[model samples]
Target: MAEQNKHLYYIDELSDYKISDGYPDVRGWDVKDIDNRVIGKVDNLLVNKEAERVVYLDVEVDKSIIDAKYDPYGRPVQTEVREFVNKDGENHIIIPIGLVDLNEDSNYVYTDIIDHRTFSETKRYRKGGNINRAYENQVLGSYQRRRTGSADSRDLDVFKDEIRLREIIREEIRRYHHDIDKDVTYGTLETHDASRPRVDDDVLIEDEIELSQRRSNDEVYDDDNFYKRREFDDKRFKKRTPGL
Candidate 1:
């Protein structure tokens, strides 16, 4: 990213995405490996404004697991035990979304290819520091290496121009926002102009139009958002169906 665009924010921080994708809100879910070993709990997600997709998942590693060495690379040789501690979110790992498996069953995300050792070995996100494209590539490449289920193989290499990547992202985001602005400016007017207002027919109007527009707005858009669905995990909200 450019010097001006080095700032990284959580997905919830972006206004347009919240209005569009309805806040993924997958934070607080557990992150695990394919075998169901607890890796971390999701702290947050990183959004690439240019790409309009989640790029990285900010995960807080479990201290007990990080403290013990585990082979994330799937090596037959057991990893030698080492001591590492989670101090001030230092143990957090920013794994790319490409490697993630969003498991709705247990509501835990999984990365089938990596483990504690990989996260501990790789260069991680430092608070208050800019993540240059080169650093980001290393992180992505690190995960990619293990994705093939191989501890030893050579199939992942792409020479990327960080500066060029920055320019491309900026250009993409600019065009995306331009189209959005154009639509916002004319969408209502276009709809109104298409249909003529008929005075003879009485308008039986309700606030359903505004409510329907909010279908993808926020937590309210959720089918049983304010109320709980039958499969709800908590008791704070009412059931979607009326109680007996």
Candidate 2:
């Protein structure tokens, strides 16, 4: 990979660096989709050395994911190319760092923005192989599309609401170390905590509202600030998600 790409390295490839202190180590943690279905496990983290921060999670997908019916409304990669890419050796997928929520105690990573259907439809590459800029863009684009809204827009919105509610409840549990008074009425989540709800900066899952056109690979690869976007922000991953 070093010969293929000079900037990005797997965590194990770096001798001096380690997952920053104060974050859970999520390697091997189960990755669950919006429906609470396990899709994969964290296999490794891809770090951008220039940014000195982790950018993507390398997930070893479950068998179910491979067998899942492809999402017809998923991203439009060329049919021949996608068929070739989804071969047996390709068992891993890369997810952007900031697009997930963590359950530290439960030992899993979760995301409500991307659904199972979309995940199944995502293109996967061989583990430990070179991940080109175009592949990264495709993965990010898929997640971004789902977050902003998709063919199943109504269903996606409901799922997001439910996920938000669950996160709020979990935060309350972490705060009081016990279940706190909460009300779920009309699909709204409310808490009775006297103190203002202390939402972890990273834990608040962001909606990618701006559907800006993704930059061309040549353009992004040449830019020094390519990884400076919100999706690659180290603070977002460092604060809430796991490490190593």
Candidate 3:
């Protein structure tokens, strides 16, 4: 039987799932603060299996964010998770997925709601450490303080506001799609053979050179089958030339 309540999993750990079509896969994209100062790289995504969507970003912070002076202004009151100092090699942190925006042109994952100071003060964990509910709430409380300024931010039911969270995510994705589509241009492929356009001479020819007719029409049929290609047949693609 499968675990019914297993909530989160790293995107990579699931072989059957993948990022949705047309949505940006933010892994490896640079993360920036509100002012666009680079803070980290998005190392991975944490998906909620039950929700069938991404819920958090696993960011591997840059040295500046890791080394910045810690501020206690928005510290969580929870005794179990009040430590803001990152242990040696504990430079990974999680940001709620709904809080970030995408820069398709620059390929950046950024948040306008959170600042660099708040990030520095949030608790960090090992790269693949177990992230429990208490630690997640602690980090959320630290960020919530910047927006609400509530003294008891830690006790508030931030994640329970599911409607608000979904709205934020939808709005960000809509805006990002709009931005990227603004500069996109389209063109048509001029193919001589409509039935086999994939291997048409106009498409296959490259480097301002046409393929010689002597090369064989068998190439057209073989070209469509990846395993029957020259690379697999010749066995030279994986190896260096003998003399060189």
Candidate 4:
């Protein structure tokens, strides 16, 4: 009865189940698992077009892995084992959907009871070390496309338009300055020549000489007055002198 019950349980668990139709269509190669949670959004897939089969998926693991040791190429090194292991002593393993009994409706898988240690060992064996190389190739191809001559032409046209606009602005500024100069005026004639009375050269010279003589006379008078005051005071003081 026990063996029969075990058989029945195995049959029940192994039956085909459909993943939800709402789930995005993922190729067998694109599926990945972390404990019970599955990560199905793959960045790239390797397809066999002739056979209509997906051979492998090329995905970028979450950047959190970089918290571990990184390689010279900036890719996280897989050698750091702690990030990959779960609390149950089972390493968080990634398995191809092809290796599992997938339930399409539930988007899950079922497997026979497996020891945690054995699962970890199997995961280490199946993990692909050269996946980063494939990613590098894809990046190189994208960069090359951007560097093509056709792409450069579009950039050149944009720069040409910028230069033409600048030239138009410079021409407008020059025209503005030209108009300003046309409206302004300048003259070299003296102010009196335009509206004030003009004196003869001899009369102007005589007036200047007369003014200079008057200033000299005023200075001489001031000096004489000071000398006279000093002499008068001295004589007055002599009269007041004591007999001794």
* Per-residue lDDT of model 4, residues 1-244, tens digit only: 2332111111112234322333233333323332433333244333322223233333333323323322222122466645323233221233222223334455433322222222222222112232222232232222222222333454344445546855665555445444644432223233443343333335435554454334334233233232222112222111122353
C-alpha positional error of residue 204 in candidate 4 after TM-score superposition, expressed in Å? 99
lDDT digits (tens) for residues 46-131 of candidate 2: 88877887888899999998887464333446655443346777889988776676877688998766778778878788898777
10 residues in a row with least lDDT, candidate 2: 204-213
RMSD of 1: 20.5
Q: Estimate each model's TM-score.
A: 0.48, 0.64, 0.55, 0.22
Q: Name model 4 segments beyond 4 Å from true.
A: 1-24, 27-34, 37-40, 70-97, 100-103, 106-244
Q: Which candidate is the best by TM-score?
A: 2
Candidate 2 residue pairs in backbone clash: none
Ranking by lDDT: 2, 3, 1, 4
Preferred candidate (TM-score higher): 2 or 4: 2
Instruction: For model 3, state the Cα shift of residue 111 in Å.
Output: 1.1
Residue-by-residue lDDT tens digits, candidate 3, 149-209: 3323422445345347556655554455446443322243543343432322243233112
TM-score ranking, high to low: 2, 3, 1, 4
Model 4 clashing residue pairs (backbone): 18-104, 18-105, 19-104, 19-105, 20-105
- Total clashes, candidate 1? 0
lDDT of 1 by residue, 1-244 (tens): 4545353467666676652332245689888875668877888777655445556678777776556644333222434532222334455667665556565546777765666556655554443244444445455545544434532222222222333544565555445544644433322444333244421112212223233333324333223231121111222111223353
True lDDT of residue 159, candidate 4: 45
